[model samples]
Target: MPHRSISAPRHRAPALPSTDYDVIIIGAGSAGLSAALSLGRCLRRVLVCDGGPPRNAPSPGVQSFFTRDGIKPAELLRVGLDQLKPYDTVEVRAAQVQRVTPGFQVFEVEAEGESGRTFTVTARKLLLATGVEDELPPVPGMRDLWGRGVLHCPYCHGWEVRGQALAVYGQGKIVTGMALLVSRWAPDLVVCTDGAGHLSPNARRRLRQQKIQLNEEPISHLEGTANGQLRHIVFKNGDKLARHALFVHPHQHQRSTLAEQLGCRLTSKGAIWINKHSQTSISGLYAAGDITPGPQKALLAAAEGTEAAIAIHETLTREECPK
Candidate 1:
């Protein structure tokens, strides 16, 4: 018999009615939904362009999100969307934004849906909640364990895997710093250099003083369960390290290029630079969430989104309202 590969089903985007709105938000994650909620409450016509596959899509559940703690990321987003039901002014479409062009008084956004249908929308203000993408190391089976046993953000997943046999995977000063941070929850921690061997003398000394084991062997692959629960770290030399959890400091990049295309200044860490008002370098452009420079957390991103919505409302009122 011939073997056949099965692919996962695709999600279809909803129909988008109009081409004009008070505010057009890109990326319908927590940050985008929060902004839309605030704007909808204020009776503003808000449109949220949600490109599927959020940053947390691979994770089983969200942590440290207050009442919604431990909830599935998708369910949390569904609840958020449901909450906006009363507001007819808010609309969400599963579409990837292609480009953003500036206009005289509004910004033009071009997006393509899953069905290859293209649409354009103009808005008085634009908000970017398009989070960052995690660039994982090329070790075999690492991608399968991502967001499960192989994780990042100590604050987000540390409590869940507390006191487990944990390993920090990466090299450089940042990885050392992350190892230190992970030490708070994991007393028995090992630092895997993954053959990079870029740790400084001071970092090595600190690790030694802290009794943290440093492994410089090249990683062959990760051994995990069918459900992505990591079991062991297999080295190229045939040695294996038993690890229940692995903390990683993977490289990250902006999920969308619309921010850079709009000329929004980026921070040293490659996140969008925004002021207290959540406004970016461009006058009518605002940003929130992991795309902006700061600690990446769902709650923090939502708060920033709310703040950005308020700032946008105030700015629009100031300009449009008659004195």
Candidate 2:
């Protein structure tokens, strides 16, 4: 026993538990890709998980994006992804994030693959660029005509259908405001409140002064041409409202509940509540793009992402070298 001494067991250095990536951007739309570009330029390790096609995938083209206006949504995203190639530290993957678990210093994320498999990743900070989804009107053909005829956001699609016969679909003050805003694009605009035109006295007076027509008949279903152009809004009593396009301020919902899961505060409008630096209620958790408050434009979202990146970089710098 004295001659044959047991050797000490060999052990590899414990794997580093710190995050391999500084940020894990949960969506790869305009915001996520934009943030990744900025962070990547800073030489930070970034992993961008592209859930799928962007929320604007149904739209024909992106508008108001400088130098890239009218570009198709997929093309714009492809360009964003291509532009990131120069940054070696950036990685992009297709993932539908399912769960997030915030830990001591890192957040664990699980994404489900197309094959029903799941993978987990961790990061020091998380950025949720997961935009919102438009819940279209319950009319029969609304879904099919969304982004084309049953539209949202006058600034984005209004130019294409400008001066055409347009109708605003919704009720209450929201639709009243939408009708007024849409009037700028379509002089021949009509406000179809479906059943009740809940316009305020001021709103109704404004509509009358503006010469915007109101239709309160309960809608039967929407009718669109074979080419996807809206033709008319059919009423329950066989009455038809001929229109080329319908502007809708449909209810919107966040595409991902990650913000809710991570305990980020939500605005009354259902957007993620972020501080000036784009950091969410929970420290180290950031949000940008349509998920945040205000308007939802591709250009605006990209700008938000860039701002968030700058803020995240500054925060990380402060944490590392506190003076």
Candidate 3:
């Protein structure tokens, strides 16, 4: 990533100043940072307000990012921030955005920091890259082993859990699909519906033909070893089935509430809808990353951020702001 030189001298804007920035980006995760890098190169005065909670905070490492696979989250951000420093156009504030509103041809941003200080930033445009969170199953011990023994995103953690005893805890058609896909990695695989009738007859037949066991009994809870490794699953019938790892498809929710509050169009699946140029229905407002409906991958999120930044630049150019 190359930094964009500031076309003009750096100057500090007043705190809580009304409508003063070219663009105010929220969240400093992969997507947010990527957007910052792009806009920073264009010499756009960009402020990134982060909630400090990234979507992949629980994951051990990032996956599927070419040439940067398995990189730690902190390390990735460090490199990204370093690259953005020379531009002097991107400022990352460790704060939580409380609310957003349209004011006098710009957007007003109200945010609070850990020090109990609240500040407001006004920008001509707003880009929301706030990512989503994984909604884990309400299973005892599941929370403790999440992102370790139990995981979501096969592409991210699948290689680590490969060749291990695996189980897919899901219902409906998803159970069979997950079981078969996981079976490719783990020879020993089981599909546990946990008493939910989600497996169709065709799916059941396929699993049986593949010699995979279909566990319909309800699961009471999961048991982990002293070292915190998942050891056995406790069924309501008092059966303790030994398993090394479990795969699940968790429910996902967007991180930013301001998008909907501002009346941006949303997809049927609850994601903010954006055009190919990353522009939302609301002019001068954009979104990227896991906030949009798609597979949640670090690379995809980063790419979406880049796209949004380019669109923002074009929009800003048309407005005749100094670049």
Per-model TM-score, in order, reads 0.92, 0.92, 0.90
What value does the lDDT take at residue 96 in candidate 2?
90
Give the number of the best model, judged by TM-score.
2
Tens-digit per-residue lDDT, 1-323, candidate 3: 89987687655433443456789999898899999999999999999987886767656778778888998777787887788889887888889999998765589899998798998879988999988877888888888888677888788888988888888998887767778878878888888788875777898899988878878899999988655577888899999888998999887777778888999999987899999889888988899999987788888999999999999999777656433
Best-to-worst order by lDDT is: 1, 2, 3
Model 3 scores a TM of: 0.90
Worst 10 residues of 1 by lDDT: 10-19
How would you encode candidate 2's per-residue C-alpha lDDT over 215-280 as one tens digit per residue?
899999999977678998999989998999998887889998788877789989898989898999
Better of 1 and 3 by lDDT: 1
Best by lDDT: 1
lDDT values, one for every candidate: 0.90, 0.89, 0.84
Cα lDDT of model 1 by residue, 1-323, tens digit = 89999998764543332448989999899999999999999999999999987899889889999999999999999999999999999999999999899876688999998799998889988999999999999999999999998998898999989989899998889888988889888879999998977988999998888778899999999999999999999999999999999999888999898888778899888999999999999988999999998788898989999999999999887666534
- Cα lDDT, model 2, residue 201: 86
Prediction 1 global C-alpha lDDT: 0.90
Residue pairs clashing, model 3: 172-198
